[model samples]
Target chain A: MNTDWKNIDAASLNNLTLGEAEKLFGLEPNFTEEELKKVRNALSRQYHPDLNPDSGNIMSKINAVYDILKNEIKNRRNAEQNNANGGATDTSSTSSDSTREEPEAENINDNAGATDNSTSENTADEPEVENLNDNAGATDNSASENTADEPEVENLNDNAGATDNSTSENAADEPEVENLNDNAGTTDNSTSENTADEPEAENLNDNAGAANNEPRNENSNITWEDVNRIGVENLTLDDARRLFNLEEDFTENDLIDAYNRLDRIYNPMNFPIGSEEAEKNRATMNSIYGVYTILRRNLINRQNVQESPTREDTTNQSTQVSMNPTNEKADNSRNDNGDENSQNIPSADNEKNDGQTDRPKDAPTHNEKPALSTGPTVGDQIASNDTTPDPEPIPVIKSIPAKIMDHRKQILIIIGIIALAIAISQAINLTLVAQMARNGNLWHLTAGVAEKAALHAKNINLTSKLIALKSSYDSLSGVWTIAGQKLLTGNLQAILRGISAGSGILGLSCLTAGLIKKKSAAYKEYKKNIRQLIRDFNDLSYDEAINQINSLRENINNSNELSDREKQLLLNQLKKAEKLNRQFEDIDQGEELEGGMSL
Target chain B: MMVDSIITLANNKNYLLLMESSILDDSYFLGVLLDDNMEPTVDYVVLKKVEKDGVVCAQQINNLNTLTQLLEEYGSEYAENYN
Candidate 1:
């Protein structure tokens, strides 16, 4: 059915549901983005203002409904994709868990085979014991024939009975061993118990393995009860390593691998939802993940300490350090053991060691003069001991001139708008002036009427002549006033037009300057050379820094690398640096400043 | 006949005849003055047939407020069609 475009108002149209919107467009529900676009285009063409003059409201409603349907379709597709991704992750975890179970099953089978062999050996010893008993009985009969043989027969019977007792004890031990193996297998196979015990066993094994310097693959002797007594919070770094099934001296990569393996096996998604196994797996996963996070944070902090540079060693290398404000803010934040850093590591177990691990444990205190107190800043390596040469700097620059030129298009558009507004204002003013000139004495009708009444009371001939003379004078005066007003308006318009033109020219010049700077080979080479010089400033002596600054000034003046404007900008920057250097000298002469300066 | 004469007069004067209605045997006409550009301007006026001396002529109703009210009533009625 077709909707009557003329009858539907915007309010009622907006309240239409998805099905109603589809009916409006003559399409089925759950249309694709492409199909919606095609239908929308057809409807747009049918009701467009150019084709149908009275269709503005209708066309707008059509577009609004089109957008609603398009967004709905897009959201549905996004939700489907997200669900697919979640399903894929669950599948991968389940597959990995199954693979892990295969090895455990093999281990259980091997244990069962050992128990069976032991049972077979006990059975073999039974027959031998029986034979010995028979032989002792025969000896006992012979001893009955002679009183001297009775003592020997008694000793033989006792020996044979002792052998039978020993064999029976061995047989009883074999069943107990088999029962223990069976219990271990049951613990591994039982979903709820295995989920709870395995992680704990692994964590304890991790600690035991570390203490014994054992390989990761060694069988765990520690029980889940021992781990429960120690508790997850009190677990040590070795426990975390064991939880990941890692050796004592594992690298970051090894830790990552172990974490991935445990994560897959213990992932709750691998189990049925809301089940006991899932809940237990979730708890175990959280424990493992928390331990892993703490260990990794400690490892990273230790690495940062070793890699940091020493300020004392670099003292002879450079006296002046260029500390940008951005770098200082970064260093202050990095060194500050505040709430923000604590929030970054969000583990309940980690909270216990917050004071110890929040900052680098090995990092020197404030009283001790550390080489480099914080992480390195971008583009400024103040105390780096790296011997390799710095790479070539990128030619990208963000100078003030370049930034202004970036808005050249917007500037041009603004100038054009201003010009158009001025022209329209001038046109309106001139139209008013022309209208005023045409109306003339019509504006002063009341005054004219009053003058005519007085003229009629006086001599008729003289009054008419005087009235004619007055009318001519009034007309001339009006013309002069209109001309003066037009002149004033014209001058104002010219001044505004001149201002607009000047701004347009300024914008164009900025655009040209930006383009020249970008394309200039000399500018590129200058930037590359200056970057290297700036990087070396932290390593140069005070006098050397001064010499370098002077040489840079001379280079700007002598070289054809930069335009006059660029040279001026560079000179201004150098002046700031020179002033800073003088301030440093004053500080050296015992004049302390409250805060430091940054470039 | 009065309506036909008013229409002819309005055409000759270049006035926009906005609305007309008949009640009993009498007809009422509403129109607005047009400027030199032929666009509507100034107040609207009511027109009716009246005999002045011996000749029948279309006379303008001079009550500007009443004419304005009538124009507003007509404007509201047709506003939905265009907008």
Candidate 2:
């Protein structure tokens, strides 16, 4: 029996993450019930053990992955449902109690009600307490009033009067609501509706503070054992958050608070360096810092992705293309990727195509891509909310020729600098050689003086003195002997002359070669730029054509050694480009003139 | 006969299972390593394939370290077959 299972191996399945597990089963993290059902049906048809009995192991892996994802999705849905139910319950309870409570006490009552059930009892028992006070009043008003009843009635009336005074002075308590709103970091509009029927949010801060205090207490009491026990090596984002004692929906402020708190305890400065305890503390601090940084970076990336998925996709693809080793292939792949991404995503595809055609080189900048901000806003709803199959943006890949054109100036400048350095060093060597030749002449003069002295001694018939002078001359001459001069039967002086001549010739040749290389490289680059300019002219990119022509001219002018013939050739090309540009302008002028005539 | 056939294929044929998760599409493939005789061997191998300019190239995942790095960079759906 044939099986359509993807054929995952054992090792691969061993370390699968929840996200990867979802992908393996072809389930989206936020997949709807219908989508999940569809995926389940499709996988079972291909990998059901009974259907494809031969691939029992493969079927088991599939079921295992599916089960994990199914449970995860089920849990997420249950959480969302519970949140919805709890919100509804809280709202109903607030509205019901606010109906009977005094306006001034409503804010305090709402806060107390949200935190504990004591406010519910307060509201429920208020009417009964008032009725008891009324009965005591009726007894005191009777002819035989009990002394116990009189004091009770007075206490009840005092309580009623106090309640009445507080409720009647609700306007005076408005300033406290403002203070509460300020403390809560909420809008003043919430406090503005206290006189209206809506439940004032004055108590929200107090209740929320009470609710947060419990978690804050627990988190503060978290021990080093709780933190150090979490292994940082394979720590995922969620695990890192847990180690930091952060909530499920932690904000940047919360992350910073956790980091600061953790850093204080684990800071190695508290311990002596080189100690085992210090080392352990240092490691703990590093892990905390790593977790904080990773969380922060992931949060920023998620924001960027959520704000403009296509732009992020485009940026990634461009980076990848830039990193590619093979220029020609990378260029083609980038274009293909752009097109492919465009097809996968609808709105982004339209924008990408518009960008590709509108400004082939610089269009991506002016197009909708740069307009996308990193911060998410409601304005991006129209652009980003489209149900594009893929969220990745297509990378605009320029061909090798275009990229070379962009960097051609920089390449030439670098080459020029290298050539200049070589020439300067060679010139310095030439001056040193001249100085060495002068030194050699001074030695020859000394030898000539020794010969003169020997001749004078011979004239005087001083044989010993003449012999000494001759020996001194021979010793002085031998110092500059070329290697293997005697074996070659060459005169030492002649060989020395030959060595000087050879070096001089070699230096001149190298200087010429360096110059020629620079000239030829520049000329080749100029030709390439001219060819690109011509192509641009043909493509009716007049502005780019003009720019290239000016650049080419500038390069030629900089190349001082360019031959007259080469300069003439470049000038002719420039003339042709300028003529074409003029023709384009004339054509535009003619169109305008025709329009004017018709008008 | 079916069980024996499955066992024989598993023991004798060098089969590499791979999944290519790309932006365009995700595809599953099996690569069979050929021996000196240009025939399939029992020893399997895993390779990382990159396609550029319509040309597809692959690099072998030789060790556990390489495999771990590959899984981290790419997703777990991709695996290299190795002997």
Candidate 3:
């Protein structure tokens, strides 16, 4: 027997019946609870997957059989208790004789008789007698009808006790009895008294039906009401995946495919409208759609996280903020403009804009180029004119020609400083270029020497020396080739050196010209005017400062004494002053607004 | 009986076709066959509807490799436009 057990395969183990399971454990079918437990523990130790790696199938089978036996024992005990409680008068003899009847059959008879007697006599004393008689009659009839299987039932009864025998027989006969009862209850209207007497029996019959029907009951238990109660927001990722019959690693396409298949299967249009099946399918479809929506959102969010792992927190915050109506509008406007500043800025005013009113009319749109004429000139005006008024008298604005002639020396001096800086930088660059050229020449010489030495070694049959020299030649040859290419392509470094030296010489000449210009009479007059203008603007209010700067700029632009380049330089300074004044105004306004809001 | 037919059809590289849709209609399906000993083997088959005996029948495509090849060739385009 032990050798036979060892020879049994997984398939045989899985196929074990209750009788076979008992034999596998080396026990009789009528084994006591303690005996069953002892055998199970011993078998589990022998077949545990941890100790025996290939014992998974055997362990699972053992566990499965144990669960079935446990449930059977529990049901048998419950049945005996119910008999003792409900049919106490007749149970002493009937329990031993009718132990081969199923617990469900007994339960139905007990309930039915109790209901019948309560209806007829308004008393429950005779309920147990009636119940016992009904069950006995049914079992006797079934046993007679299934005479061919009587020996098997008798064998079970003799060896495994009456409860085990009943279980085996009931499993085979319960469905047939359930169907018979259903037909009798429904179509046998002629037996009105019987119907009236045993109304609860039909329900018990249904409850006792096969395990295969349990899944349908389970599926039907989920209703639209339940789905609504557990809203999409509350559904977990696992629940959604289970609904779609999908795995964790499923992609967006996989989710879509699952949804499509479910949609096709539960399509309400496939059923007749307003029918129960149609209503059920519609509810199922809605539930599926809810699941699909949740899973799709999860898939999208997962992909987004994977694509930008570094930006997850920022993305989540942005998504949360974007949910607000105000922020959503602001985001849409910013997105439409495609401006980096619009995206980067997180101001309340931007949120309030809603596609209009926020952006300046003259500001560039996403596609349009900045209007260059207005940009610098308007900036110059804003910087100069948007300042506070001064208590002191301001200097009168001069004509462009007068302003230029006055500051001519200062301008020349600025030009000389710029030239000197350029000359110094160019001299440094020229030195670096000369060093690079010398390095290239040295590399070229080394390449030629290595090539010749490789040839000399090869001619003398010095193999190792030749190989080493060849390697050096190869490396130096690459550098030499690059140098030769550069030389062929116009000796770029020499050209660079020449250009640097020429620039330095030109810078010296400019410095010399500027120094001569700086000693002129016009230079002294313009220097005083410029210094006075700066001192007056320093004490002025924002408006006054802006006005004075704009007037100065007009003078610079209109003056014939000033060249375009000189005029441009003066206007740029004005633009900077104007920007500074505007920024000061904005800061002051912001502070006032914040103070007001706080109050 | 169904298990016997499946095993026979599988060995012969052929499969049964149910000549009417009765709940099981899909691009892919899994069928479980329980032997006399109640040991179960699961097989995945692709379902294709075809006209057999002048009636629409869901024919089980038993060859997994063939199904995979076909899916590889056309699955993406079909999935994208299925809606």
Which lDDT values do the candidates have, in the order given? 0.34, 0.33, 0.34
Displacement of the residue A236 alpha carbon in candidate 1, Å: 0.7
Q: Give a tens-digit lDDT track for model 2, residues B1-83.
A: 11001111222432223222332222212233435453334333334443446543343333222222222222222111110
lDDT of 3 by residue, A1-599 (tens): 25243445423332234456566667675666667666665664466432344442344345445643443454456657876687545342234223333332332343332233222221122222122232222212222222333343333223321112222233344343334234322222123432343342223222111111111111111112223222322233443553454545567545644554343334333333334433444434445554664454344344434333233232222212211112233344434543322221222233234222233443321112223422222212222221222122112111111112213222222222222212211221111111111121112122223333333334333432233242232223222322222332344342222222222212222223322334333333332343344434324567887788877777777777766665664575466456545644543333321221111
By the TM-score metric, which is better: model 2 or model 3? 3
TM-score of each: 0.18, 0.18, 0.18
For candidate 2, lDDT tens digit of each residue in A193-277? 2213212223333211322212111111111222222223223343354445454345655555444334323443323323443
DockQ of all predictions against the true structure, Cα-based: 0.00, 0.01, 0.01
Q: Tens-digit lDDT track for model 1 on A274-368?
A: 45433444434444444554354334333445453333222211111111111233223323433222121112222223322233333332111
Clashing pairs in 1: A206-A242, A310-A371, A311-A371
Compared with the true structure, what per-residue lDDT tens digits does model 3 show for residues B1-83? 12122222222233321111112222332223234543332222334443445543435442322232222222222212221
Give TM-scores of chain A for all candidates.
0.20, 0.18, 0.19
Stretches of candidate 2 off by over 4 Å are A1-227, A233-239, A242-254, A305-599, B1-83
Model 3 docking tier (incorrect/acceptable/medium/high)? incorrect
Total residue pair clashes for candidate 1: 3
Compose the digit string of candidate 1's lDDT tens values, residues B1-83.
Answer: 22211133423543444445432233445544446665444444455444455544455643222222233233323222211
